[model samples]
Each structure stands twice: as structure tokens, then as C-alpha cells.
Target: MSLARTFVGFSSTDINYYRLMTAWKANTNIDFDFVDCQLQNSINSENEVYIKKLCRERIGMASKFIQLIGQDTRHKYKYVRWEAEVAIEKGCTIIGVNLNAARKMEQDTCPPILRDIGAIFIPFSPYIIKYAIENYSMGPEDWYYYGNEIYKGLGYE
Candidate 1:
């Protein structure tokens, strides 16, 4: 099956979790896959304008945007917040993956730009993430999250 073209955003400190997601995509045994819209390499230049330009190019290619929510994600305004803003401006569906494994949006960890904005929040697990990418869509609400039953169906919990 074809993979969804997705742009994922996170704080630089959370790169390891992002790498794990890439590993999930690479593992044939896992049912997760996506055409990652992140920059193939970290931008070496310290120029903010050049960096944002490249990030915009990548985010533009995606129909979905996933934010990896970690402890300090809410405070990072440079790229992570700007990236989410760009994704929203481009009309991409937002999916928040809590690195803490919270199945719902944690107001403490979620970036303010993402709050009350009709984004689906899920745990950082391959099964639930794959299911969200394949089946979930934004609905009109303050925010969205799957119930315990949905998680149970995915063998979570």
C-alpha cells in the first residue's frame, strides 16, 4: 500500500523519538510507513531565514502533520511552533503524538498553537500512530482523542 506523505515536527532534543519513528517505517515487520516530509539532513547553516525556507518546502509536500509532543515542545517557538503554524496555514491535518504516551492532549506539553485547534492526539506507539494516519481525520471540536476502547482495539492498554 502507498504511504501517506506526512510532515512531523518536534523539539531538537526529541530527535531520538523521531529516529525511532523512522525506524518503524523501515521495519518490514511493522505495519507503519510514511513518506517523511522532514528535511533529509539537518540544516548546517545558522541562518533562520534559510532554515525556515527549507522547512516550508518540506511541510508543503505533506497532507498531514504530526507533532511529537515532549516536555519542552510547548516552549520551543523557533521551528516547532513555526512549523505547526505553517502546517495549519497549508490546511494539513494535525496529529499530536505524545512522547509521554498520554492518549490524550496534555495541555502542559502541547504547543499553544496546537491547542483548541481540532488536532487528534495519540500515544507514541506504532500501532496507534499507524491507525491514526490511516483512519483519523480532523473534526470540529476543541481537540480530538481516541477513547480507551479504540486504544484497546489497537492492542494498546
Candidate 2:
């Protein structure tokens, strides 16, 4: 059987993604990577090409794109928008998160723009995220997961 793909995006300010990611890593092995929104400033034009190329590489390899549907991820950052878009354009199935369960403050998941872009919103609780990561090849989670590994990937620790 072929493996299912899921690319997760998030709001820059949503600290919850980190915490929840910790829970997810503890629970399962998702074999995931992340794109950093805050560090795009230092990237030069040469790096930009490499980045976009990487986006293509990632989307090309992926079977689904998981959007975290954070407050600003879709609008504030250009790279993320491009990543999601390229992922979609590359025929990677798009999976949007149901923010109702992951976040507690504001309501709803999958922003209007994401909806306009044609992403499928999957209702996901923490437990569900864990389960999905484990069994994604079987059925496909194609949605949200908290990711603490981001900081580590960025050399934060």
C-alpha cells in the first residue's frame, strides 16, 4: 500500500502547536518536518529559490497536505501560503484541521481563504491526532498535529 501524506501548517502565535506536538511525538511516530515562518527574514534570494524548490520537493513527495489553520499562517506568511498552494497544485490532497478541538479560545477551524482554496476540514481531538499519525498509511490522518520538534529543527535548543 502507498503511504498517505499530510503537511501541517500553523499560526505563528499559537503556542499551543508546540505543546500539542509534544503530546503527539510522545504518542506516535509521524515522520514529519516543518517550515519556519519567523525566520524567513534572513533568507536571501538564492535561499528563496532553494526554499521554493524544497516546497516542490516536499509536495511532490507528499500525498496529502495538512493545514493547521492557525490564525495567521494562511495570510501572514508568504512561504506557507505557497507551500500549501504548491502542495495543492501538485495534486497533494489537502486536509484542514478542525480548530474547535485543538484550540479552546476562539471557535471554528479552516479559515475562509483555506476554504476557498478547497481543503477538507477534519474534526480532530488530541487523541484522534495521535491515532491518525499511527495509522495514516492505512486510512490517512491528513490533518492537524502539535509539533514541538519545530523548535529543535530551528536549532532553538
Candidate 3:
């Protein structure tokens, strides 16, 4: 199956990071959209209800969530944790990509929840992504339909 929908979360500061996902889409010819949860001004003014509503307003909903687990994420943003939890609660498949060593030779790091959630670990590299996408047989159609059902149940409409 072809890889279709995916939820991408990263520090809004991480611009280059967004490009990596785009590159994957280009190479694989897959329809992948990145969900930007970057709190630009402040979440203080952002009401809880709106935040929850915006949380579910994805530009393109994907069946899989490629969470970029980094040290900065846990510190810089709390919403990352919330979004991941929401996705998991909704039963979306989460794929943990270790980009530490993928970019740097340094030891790779990942969020603790990844281990607890039993997320599949993939080396942060284009080669590994290609392999995983090919080996996994999930298309965007299945992802979109299933994700839509889950979101609608949660009042995404």
C-alpha cells in the first residue's frame, strides 16, 4: 500500500525539519501534510475550547503520526504532548522516527512515552523511510476514512 496521510509535529522554530517531511513526500509521491501546532504569540489568550477545536483541525488528516521526538520538544511545548496523546487516544498509529543520529552522529534520544506507547522506531534517514513506506501497506484512503470517522466522533465537524 502507498503511504498517504501523516501528522507531523515539530518545534515551529524547526523550519528545516519541515523540509525533511516534504522531501519524503516528494520522493515517495505520497500525500503527506504537516500539522503545525507552533504557538506563535501565546496560548494564554488561546482559550481551551478553541485549542481543543484547533487541535483537531488538521489541514490533511493522516492515518499515521510521525512524531519528531526531541529534547527541545518536551521543554519548548506542552501541546506536543497533548496532541500526541489525543492521537493515541483516538487510535491513530504513531511512528517514532529517531532523527538524532539520522542527522548527527550523537546518540539518539526519544520521548519516554514512545517506549510506553510501543511506537515503532525508525532510523532517521531517507533510506529507512523509503524501506518502511514500501514495507508498510497502508494507503491514504484508509487513513483519511478511518481518521475522519474518529475525528467526527470527537466533534471535528
Candidate 4:
């Protein structure tokens, strides 16, 4: 299958989790892969406009946006939330990966921009995430989450 062009949004505090995702893809044993479209390097300026301009360019290349929802994700207005906003504007399929391991969107942790938009939420597991990236499509529902039966089918308890 062709790799899905994906952009991931997350708070700076959760960078380690994002790194782990990269590790999952790098490991030959893991059944996870995607063409990541994140910025290659940090922009050398504090200018929000310049930063956002670079981010927008990257987001435009993605067909999917995976938001790593951490404790401060809702409060991170600087870039994390804005990235999701741009992804929505670009018509990317939104996938909210709960770092806290929630199968559904947690009202307390989800960012305002992703709440009403058509998106799917899943735990931070590589299997479920890969499954979403491969199988999910935006539909009429504002939010989507797989039932336990579906997770069980994916070998999740």
C-alpha cells in the first residue's frame, strides 16, 4: 500500500512520545508506517507568522493529521492547536491519539479546534494508530471511536 502522507501535532512537552512513534516506524517488526510531513527542522525565528508559514506548507502535503493529545494540548495555542486548525482547513483526515490511552476523545484534554471537526480518537498504541491511518475516512460524524470489539479484533484487550 502507498504510504499515507501524515502530519502529527503535539505539545512540545510530549516530544518523547512523538519520537517513540518514529521508532515504531523504524522498527522492522512493527506494522506501522507513514510518510511524515512535519517540519524538517525548527525554524530559526521567533516570528509566529514565519513559523506558521512553514508549518502550513508542511500541513498542505499531508492527507492525515494525528494529534497527540496530552494534558496541555488544549492549552497549547502557539502551534499545536494552530497546526490542527490548518490541517482541518486543508481537509486532512484528523486522528486524535490520546497519550493518556483513551479510546475516545477526552473532553478535558482535546483541543477546541479538533472537538467539533470530523475526527477519530484512539489510544496511543501503534497497532490501533496504524489501523486508523490505513482504514479510517472522515464521515458525517463529528467524532469517531472504535468499539471494544473492534479493538479486540486488533488484538487489544
The all-Cα superposition gives candidate 4 an RMSD in Å to the true structure of: 1.0
lDDT of 4: 0.92
Model 2 worst lDDT run, 10 consecutive residues: 33-42
| Model 3, position 104: C-alpha lDDT score | 18
Model 3 over residues 1-157: C-alpha lDDT tens digits? 4454566665555547657766665654654333333333344545767765666655125556666755565554466666777667766666655556332111335554444454555545554444443344333321111233433443334
lDDT of 1 by residue, 48-128 (tens): 999999999999999899999999999999899999999999988899999998989898999988888889999899999
- Which lDDT tens digits does candidate 4 get at residues 79-104? 99889889998999999999999999
Cα-based lDDT for every prediction: 0.92, 0.50, 0.51, 0.92
The CA lDDT at 52 in model 2 is 72
Residue 139 alpha-carbon offset, candidate 2, angstroms: 16
Candidates sorted on lDDT, descending = 4, 1, 3, 2
Best by lDDT: 4
- Tens-digit lDDT string for candidate 2 (1-157): 3334545555556547745754554554643333322222333566777867755665676666666666565454566677766766776555555555442112343444455443445434444443343343322333333344632443333
Given candidate 4, what's the lDDT at residue 22? 94
Q: Residue 150 in model 1: shift from native, Å?
A: 1.4
- As a whole number from 0 to 100, the lDDT of residue 45 in candidate 4 is 97
